[model samples]
Target: MISKLRFNTVVGKKVLMAVTGLAMVVFLIGHLIGNLQLLWSGAQFNGYAHFLTAQPVVILIELGLLAIFLLHIVDAVVLLQGNYAARPVPYHTKKWGRSKSKRSKKTWASTMMMWTGIAILLFVPFHVWHFKYHNPVASARPDSGQVSPVVVGVGSTGVNTSGAASAPSKEAYDLALQVTKEFKNPFVSGIYILAMILLGLHMYHAISSALTSVGANHPRYQTLIIWGGRIFTVVIAGGFLLIPALILSGLIDPAKTLATAQAANNQVAQVPMGVGK
Candidate 1:
């Protein structure tokens, strides 16, 4: 009977989903923390971005992240197909019995996570293309107005240096500023806000599910996982959503942030090599 069950055939797929999901969650936490630097001031946010993107370690992390993202998508598609194949017969009746029916009911986060996952999967490549692949200056161009390119340079400690060119067109600093500014459009901003909400909902379910998948669930630890999931969801989602809102409200200045980052880069460039010689 055990041999007939063919359990091993599907174990690899299950393991893939669990491991990839866990990696994604860890990445989300780090991403959210970096974003929260926006609250400190424009300089703080830009510096944080600069620091993150400048590191060799971060570059390696990003490559690993890309791999995990692809793995998750591949696993999801495979599992979905397998599930469809396993349930080839359609249910003939609506009644699944009271107990089973009740069990089917799920929280909004739990119910919508699959859809949210799909949305995020769609959104990510577009996001990377817009920011990471495009020219930062072109990407940051005001949709309907003309403003002189403002170049803000960093001093010894986050101060602007003189004679620096306008911020580069393809840097992360420029891309982030552009994103905040672009959301001034109500339609665009609304969609971004909704996407963030969906992300939050996805995290709410994914976090707890990951814990269970990893065999971490227990009577004593179950409640802890649930509460932790909710908090993680809210913090990450809320923080990201706040960025566009703040930009729309004119509370955050992307241009200024970009300027600071550029200046910081310049300062580092200006450091004379072999000064002791």
Candidate 2:
């Protein structure tokens, strides 16, 4: 069954794509919720980021998400190649050409899926590196628009179940500081907005397509599925867009509740490298 579900057969490949696409949609919804927290407070957003990175469970979840993304993209490329091979040339050249061009103009969302996917693929690695892997050094002086961070260690200050002091815990990175720096960049913000719009376009068509491919085709529910696709695109993409928009617009202040560069560095200076986790 597993072997049959690989990429050899067209039906199997479509099913796989539908499954993976839906998985990504779930991730997008969760990510959007996390990011929307940025609108409330820097500490909240930073704390959320710290929560994701400081726990092993979150790391495992991240790994699983990465695998899902890889599978989706790889499978999509294979399917695309198979489609091109199966129809090397239009059987009815003039007739097919006119209709294809008309369809392209009419359904821009569907037509641009492959191109938008490629654009998003190119942007994600840099985004993850900038926001996740790299951190601003605490010693450097950040301008009003720029920011950096240092990880802070948790102390034995928590009240235990028996009303005793709990043991000291691990350190957590200052993610808000890092995010503020990245989002404050006009160039980066611009590109991110563009990529997200592209992502929305990709999702708009993808949602309905996945539903159809997966055989969610009851006439009574078809309209709902189609509308659901649109709603998902707007909600997920618009939710994700809010963070950068707030930062760029100066609504989310990096220095308001988030850690300052000097403060971050000072907190982590005594702790050894990699001890924050």
Query: Which residue pairs overlap in candidate 2's backbone?
Result: none
Query: How does each model score on TM-score?
Result: 0.71, 0.75
**Candidate 1 whole-model C-alpha lDDT, 0 to 1:** 0.63
| lDDT score for residue 192 of model 1 | 72
Instruction: Provide the lowest-lDDT 10-residue window in model 2.
Output: 154-163
lDDT of 2 by residue, 1-277 (tens): 8865565689888888899889988888888888777677656765565455434476578788899899989998998998899987776534335375643322678778899999888988977776645453222212212222333221222211111122223333345555666788888888888889999999988898899889996789877877798897998888778778778888876546544544644354345544442
Worst 10 residues of 1 by lDDT: 161-170
Q: Where is model 2 more than 4 Å wrong at Cα?
A: 1-7, 91-106, 136-172, 259-277
What would the C-alpha RMSD of candidate 2 be, to one decimal place?
7.5
70-155 in candidate 1: lDDT tens per residue? Answer: 98888778778888899899788755354566534257777676799999998788666755554232222222133323212123
- Candidate lDDT scores, in order, read 0.63, 0.66
